[model samples]
Target: MTGTRFDPSWFEAHHVNLSATERRAATLTTRRTVKKDWQAAWLAQAITCIDLTTLAGDDTPSRVQRLCAKARQPLRDDIMAALGLDALRVGAVCVYPTMVAHAVKALEGSGVPVASVATGFPAGLMPLSLRLAEINYAVDQGASEVDIVITREYALTGQWSKLYDEIAAMREACGPAHMKAILATGDLQTLGNVYKASMVAMQAGSDFIKTSTGKEGLNATLPVSLTMVRALRDFREKSGQIVGFKPAGGIKSAKDAIAWLILMKEELGTRWTRNDLFRFGASSMLGDIERQLEHHVTGRYSAANRHAMA
Candidate 1:
């Protein structure tokens, strides 16, 4: 099928059912990771948060540029503070390049990190060196994590080597920061492409391999997330290597977050801790999750009670 279209079965072949013992082992791992001081230290992490700058990309009179700018600091702070104050493990705060420092500074000491999108993000349309520079600049400015989008065209066309190089370049650029490689899964034709992309991304040194850019038509989905989580699990078993998983884009609400958590429980199981193991990568999701927490904790919800970070 070199010249033919990619088939999802090409990937399904390796994803067989686990044995009873294997399943039990997976459950134990999940309990350990999920049960860790999680209630007091981080409850929202029961569903990781998200990265959202493009929410301003719509055609509203709200002005995308200024909205993006405002969403930069206030959104990050709002997310961090709400999660922080609620005693939920605040997930990382994601931001665009210029505002990463603000996200970094605002999230300081909260155990929440600053995640910056880079490497010709969204479009992945730029020179290799320039992309690397963008990554380095963000990390140097205090981003604890770097999310770099892969050239979807390259991955789709079987240009695995080029894709590998881009991942490696971005990894090097991140220095000590965790590098999350965005597959922009919607652009790919099949699950096989996502599988191949995930393996290649991890092999090329990405600390985490994400499912979508949140800019793609479909963004993240259960099937797509299941594909990546399974890939990461298998890769870990054989290589004794652990790679993180993130399902970004379109994820809003506690139910969506719980569904993703269920997928992680069934697929990757316990190693899915609060940090690099998983994250939501959203803009508005934190607030939604907060409302859920408030309802669960205090049994009341009012628009006036919603806290916004100054």
Candidate 2:
């Protein structure tokens, strides 16, 4: 249900020009502007689209629970009241596979879905059997969505067929849960590869094609995001099916979120701007957004310490 049957020809025919893409990405930030209440409103929408996350080497059950709490009630009561919002919650909570059960339990009774990073996240270098098993294990543990990592080697080695097969298997293993394929584009090395991998993943049934794992030295740049979204557009035109996009890693500021939102609106139209189709896989971004919203309502800036993520 997530992606269509794989067709090698679809991916082989795709091509992207780096210069044109760079030029387009460079204009996304300056072409649109939001001020005062309008900016506040966009920031609030960004809050709801966030996959409020906590994936640290030293993450504990307590930490995951705290993060879940923030996901359920992302904004302060005063801020919500001032903004005239009765209930505001983030899109989901993303955590490592080991913490999926904890995140699910913590978000019990809340509508927020618990998303777990699977398939040897950040590197995705494990055996194919182990990766598929990991997806099944997380789904069994009550994860509503599974964020899987594609084998970067397949992309690097130009093995599009191997990459497509691996993602198709992962999608099958995900069963009822939605599957998000993380391309880890930083290692893909070129915008052309990013476009190819995006197409391959979509063909293999990726519910969402994510930009990064947040572990890469260079992750989630505007040019790369533009390339991926254009691929999504091309995919939709050919297949008449819509796939989602998620940009993870280093997107910490409210300004950065606005830029991404503009990109979605300008390229894919406003339909892709909602929580179902777009997500920001971030942890610290919520704090900054909260602070900006508070400034808009109260005419004063709050210290970053005042807006704690968890």
Candidate 3:
């Protein structure tokens, strides 16, 4: 009877995967997100400001690397001179997996958390077991947060089930630490696709949904961030689960950071804070924020000043 009633090709074609109603319900969640008020959001910057420092890049120019090393030593000694560094910061230094130890060593007594990217990041092309081993290795090396990538190939192929399964397995491998699922929105190709990927990411146990790996071409853009914000806002309503959002790549200024701030306000409201649910995966951004903060307080930007700590 079952065989008589089912046709293989017909079953594949007629799979009632998600009815229009269910699809819409999965999206456009009912819970209202914190309305976007740039002034209000910026006003609340007292506690929401985070100094995101990510150092993974494609073109790791030796000149810049030498410059950062030079900056690191003096910056470590001169941090007290900076306004933000002098204040209570949610101390964190994010870096590539290979540099986890370097970052951990950089902020030893500063109480900052160390975050590193794993699982064949940017491209997400390695084997699943290898990705798990990378996570375990990073944790073993003392990284508090592990940013992993979803299997974009599967998601792009419209294999939602495979995408969900991969993310879930990665989440399980994270084991006690926070898992930031980099959606790689730029590669996903559409806001609609971004939303769908975001949903699958959260459902599969992503503690945070990130925008990019900073290695891709169209890393982080406002439209993509907006798409992710809307998705998170909707997911929160339907599942009562709060997830963090991180926009990395091509983010090089404080102005860009402010836009993300405003977007989070519009999408998630007051829940967007330092520890609760917000982070920027950045490399050159900290120096920029510090420069802007100095410009805000001093009316001038320092072209030569390369490190916030310095």
Candidate 4:
């Protein structure tokens, strides 16, 4: 979804109530307990919304191919059949720009989109021209989605216009490929800054506003996610445009997955729980989820090695 025009005033007066946000986030996991079949259903739903990622310095073509294979069949055949399903696939496979071609070739005919992290991912310290070039390169290499990092310095210094301009340029570079603006909230310093950055990103045409790059000191947290979700809700109310949310970094385990699903359901309704509206930026989290599903099906847990990602 391409976004609307820049509007600064939409979030000018917005400030997060730290304690209040914390209080609400605290209740999401405990508010309602979905056990047995219901819990399995939620976990299965979470599997489809995952952006199965492997962004590392040691990444290789073979590794990416294996990752794509997992994306194609996240759950074992026995588990899928026991759950009474035909197939289960992840939302997308995310990789670095240079790995886009490899992922695309590997995931061919699998109905899975390849997402590449561009615009100097993780740090975004490169020059503007180079960053935009990186995005173009990834798209040219067959990336269906591009995750671009915003210049946190711009937001930290309160230069909203600058942030909008750069992100807009990145969005333009993305062309038809979906753009996910990675705000790296861990470095933004405050929830208020997080809200404004989310507004600016959606205004600049980001299809999704991500919580982090998964490299920050403090990655995704419930309070930060709540702030961004509220901002997206406000933007939707004012502009009538819906943008997706992705909370990445340090989100592992089946319990964490359910907690995020709960957050989306309680705050934005069932629509946000879909892959098109919400995604979990995760890697190891899938293994734990598979283990839990196995337990639900067989009444016994399996070893982590049995559910290897790649």
Q: Clash pairs of candidate 3?
A: 36-266, 54-282, 91-112
Off by over 4 Å in 4: none
lDDT winner among the candidates? 4
The window of 10 residues in a row where model 2 has the poorest summed lDDT is 1-10
Winner on TM-score between 1 and 4 is 4
Better of 1 and 2 by TM-score: 2
Number of clashing residue pairs in every model? Answer: 12, 0, 3, 0
Report lDDT per candidate: 0.66, 0.92, 0.64, 0.94
Better of 2 and 4 by lDDT: 4
Highest TM-score among the candidates is held by which one?
4
lDDT for residue 290 in candidate 4, whole number 0-100: 94
Candidate 4 C-alpha lDDT tens digits along 88-112? 8898999998999999999999999
- Candidate 1 lDDT tens digits, 2-96: 01122333343544333533454344434544332344234455434444443233333233333333333332344446445534334565667
TM-score of 4: 0.99
> RMSD to native for every prediction?
7.6, 0.9, 8.5, 0.8
Looking at candidate 1, what is the lDDT of residue 97? 74
The 10-residue segment of model 1 with minimum total lDDT is: 1-10
The C-alpha stretches of model 1 lying farther than 4 A from their native spots are 1-43, 47-86, 300-310
